[model samples]
Target: MEAAISTLITEFKKYAGKDGSSSTLSKDEFQSLVSSQLSHFVKNASDPGTIDQLMGSLDENNDGELTFTEFWQLIGKVACQQGCFSQ
Candidate 1:
């Protein structure tokens, strides 16, 4: 679990830094991250509209960017949807 969390943090930082904003993920950064790293999880990764919609949904404060917390929430949602349960 620790290693998985660490990896998630590393990926987030890597993507966020793409746009020179090591604090948040811009639209392009988010798209690149999802398409390149989360292609297996996110559907239609190559669709611009899908990426835009996802980015909009994840932007809680309407800041047009995704924070680490927001990104984690998205992961949780995808996990639940994929039935990655331990029951």
Candidate 2:
């Protein structure tokens, strides 16, 4: 679990650093991250419109970028859907 958490942080940073911010993910960075890292977990992961919609949903402040916490929401949701935390 600790390793997984560390990997997640590492992965997030890897992509999040693609742009100038190094703190949030722009649409393109998010798309790249999802398509490459989360393809198996998210359907139509590389579709532009799908990524657009997902970005809209995750951009809590409508800033057109996703902070770490916002991105974590998707991870948590996917994990729950996959029954990773089932009792």
Candidate 3:
């Protein structure tokens, strides 16, 4: 659990830093991260429209960037969809 959490943090920081802000993920950064790391989990990862829609839905504050909290929502959603929390 600890390692998993750490990896998530590390991955987030890795991509988040690509656009100068280490705390938020720009659209391109998010797209790159999704394509490179979440291709299997995110459908249509290669589609720009799909990525835009996903990013819009996840960008709760409408800031055009995804904070760690917003990014975590994606992780939670994916985990739930994958039955990671199923008993």
Candidate 4:
């Protein structure tokens, strides 16, 4: 579980940059990133429908994009649910 979370953080850094120093991800970018990285964990895996569902759930403002905060919140939630992060 720690390895999985670490892998996610690594991949996110690749796209979003370390500490999100790079440009923020647009909705499409977030979708692609999540699809590729979280494929194994997402219910429909790499399917577009699944990606859309995840975005809908995570994009709090309905802006169709996830800020770093939103992205991290989703990751933390998933990690906790999976027992990767203790409560």
Candidate 5:
């Protein structure tokens, strides 16, 4: 579990471009990162919509963006679900 968490953090850094030390991301940056890294999962979601829906659902503020915490919460929700990526 530790290794998995570490790998997850590393991947998030790769996407977030902050070495996993920060907890904020511009809305566009977060959307781009998630769409690319999580393509398989997002594509397989039950709704089958693009990453836009995922971002919109989590953006909360409707500012067309997401903070790091929001991004993590979205990813964590998917990761915590069984077979989310398998679709």
Candidate 6:
């Protein structure tokens, strides 16, 4: 569990760093992260419009980029949907 969480953070940093912003994910960076790393988890992961909608939904501050907190909302939602916390 610890390893999985670590990997999530690492992956977030990796993608977030792609466009010179190690602290947030731009739309293109988010798209790349989702399409490449989360395709199996996200529906329509490769579709640009889908990505656009997701980015908009998760961009809590309407800043056009996703901070780690915003991005974590997605991870938590996906995990819950997958029953990752179910006993």
TM-score head-to-head 2 vs 6, winner? 2
User: lDDT per model, in order?
Assistant: 0.90, 0.92, 0.93, 0.69, 0.63, 0.93
Question: What lDDT tens digits, residue by residue, belong to model 4 across residues 1-34?
Answer: 8997787666665776433345455656776687
Q: What is the clash count for each candidate, in the order shown? A: 0, 0, 0, 0, 0, 0
Query: How would the candidate models be sorted by lDDT, starting from the highest?
Result: 6, 3, 2, 1, 4, 5
1 or 5, greater by lDDT? 1
**Residue 71 miss distance in model 4 (angstroms):** 0.7
Candidate 6: what lDDT? 0.93
Better of 3 and 5 by lDDT: 3
Task: Give lDDT tens digits, candidate 6, residues 27-86.
Answer: 999999999999999999999999999999999899999999999999988888888675
What digit string (tens of lDDT, one per residue) describes model 5 on residues 1-87? 899778767766666564333445554556566666666666644333555677777887776656656776876677766455542
Clashing pairs in 1: none
**Which wins on lDDT, candidate 1 or candidate 6?**
6
Runs with alpha carbons beyond 4 Å of true place in candidate 3: 84-87
List, residue by residue over 1-87, the lDDT tens digit for candidate 1. Answer: 999899999999999998767999999999999999889989999799999999888899998889999888888888887897642
* Residue 59 in model 4: lDDT: 79
Clashes of 3: 0
After superposing candidate 2, which stretches have Cα over 4 Å from the reference? 84-87
Model 6 earns a TM-score of 0.92
Listed in order, each prediction's TM-score against the native is 0.91, 0.93, 0.93, 0.64, 0.57, 0.92
Q: After superposition, which runs of candidate 5 have C-alpha atoms over 4 Å from their true positions?
A: 18-22, 44-49, 83-87
